[model samples]
Target chain A: MEEIKEIMKSHTLGNPVRLGIMIYLFPRRRAPFSHIQKALDLTPGNLDSHIKVLEKHGFVRTYKVIADRPRTMVEITDYGMEETRKFLSHLKTVIDAIHF
Target chain B: MEEIKEIMKSHTLGNPVRLGIMIYLFPRRRAPFSHIQKALDLTPGNLDSHIKVLEKHGFVRTYKVIADRPRTMVEITDYGMEETRKFLSHLKTVIDAIHF
Candidate 1:
C-alpha cells in the first residue's frame, strides 16, 4: 500500500517542471508565483497550469493574502511531503546509478 | 553514476504502454508480435511502433527465423532485465498506495 503511493509520487514527479515545483515547495513550505517562475524559468501560463493540477491533487495548498496588496502563495501539504520523500528516494536511486 | 542510469531507466519506463511491453516481455524470454498484441489487447500498429522503439534502445532483441515460414520473435536483453527490475520496483510502490 505504501509502495503504491510511492509509485504515484514518482509518476507525478516524473516531469521536469512538476518535479521542479515539488522540489522548490518542499523545502520552504510556501512560495508565490513569481518565486517559482523565477526559479524554474517557466512562463507564467505554463507554471500556473501545472500548479493548478498539483493543487487539485491535494499535493499543494494555495492562499491569497491581503496586507497592502493581494498576494498568492503556495505550500506543500502533508500528503505532498510524503509523496515528495518517496519521489526523492526514487530519484536518488536513479541518480546513484548514472555512470557517465 | 549507476544512480543516473537507474533514473534514466525509470524515466524510459514511465510510459504505461512501454511499461506494459516490458512487463509482458520480462516474464517470457521471447515472443512474436501477434502474441504480445493479443496479450496486451493493443492494436498491431501500436504494438509495432513501441516494439521498434524498444528494439532501437537495445532493451529488446528481434530475430527473424525461416523454417517453413518466416517468424519474428522478440526477447528482453540483459540491459532490459536491469531496467525492468527498477520499473517493477517503482511500480510496486505505486500499486501499494492505491486506496479504494
Candidate 2:
C-alpha cells in the first residue's frame, strides 16, 4: 500500500490517459502521435495536453519525423521507462494483495 | 485503455489510500479501525479522513462494536467490492498488455 502511494505520487502518469500512453509506448518505445491518438481514442487537443505533461516530467519527448509528410512522434525516455516499470510493479503488488 | 479510463473515473477509489483501504477490507469484509491503521501504517487522523471519503461514496460503512471498550469497525459494502473487482480487472489488462 505504501508502495502504491509512492508510485501514485508520480502525478503525470497517474492519469489513465497518460498511463495508457505509457503502456502503449513501453514496448514500442516510440510511436507516431496519430497512432497514439487513434489507439487511445483521444482528441488531438487532449492527446497534446497529456503529452505536454509527460514531456514536462521528462517521461516522454515529442518530435517530428519528415516522412511522406511531417508527422509528430512521441518517444518514452529512459527515465520514463524506469518510472513506468516501477509504477507497473507497484500496481501488480496491489493487485496480488487483493484476493477477489 | 478505454476500460482503464472508465475504471479510473471512480475518483474515490483512485486515491492510493482509499484503494488500500478497499483492498484491506475486501478479504476480511470487515475490520477494526485500529487494525486497518496498523496494517496501512496510517495515522488515526489520516485513516479517519480516508474513511470519511469512502463512507461518503458508500464504499464502506463505519460503526462501533462494543468490546473491550468501544472500537470502530469498517466494513466494505457490496458496491465497493464490485467496483474494486472491476478496477483490478482493468488494471490486470493494462499489466498484461505491457510486455515488461
The best candidate by DockQ is 2
True contacts kept of each: 0.02, 0.30
lDDT of each: 0.68, 0.85
lDDT of 1 at A77: 93
Residues A7-84 of candidate 2: C-alpha lDDT, one tens digit per residue: 546677667678878988999999999999887777999999989999999999999999789999999999999999
In model 1, which regions exceed 4 Å deviation?
A1-9, B1-100
Question: Least accurate stretch of 10 residues (summed lDDT) in model 1 chain B?
Answer: B1-10
Docking class of 2: acceptable
Q: Enumerate clash totals for all models, in the order shown.
A: 24, 0
Which lDDT value does model 1 have at A10? 52
Best by TM-score: 2
Q: Please state what fraction of the native interface contacts candidate 1 reproduces.
A: 0.02
In candidate 1, how many Å is residue A76 off? 0.6
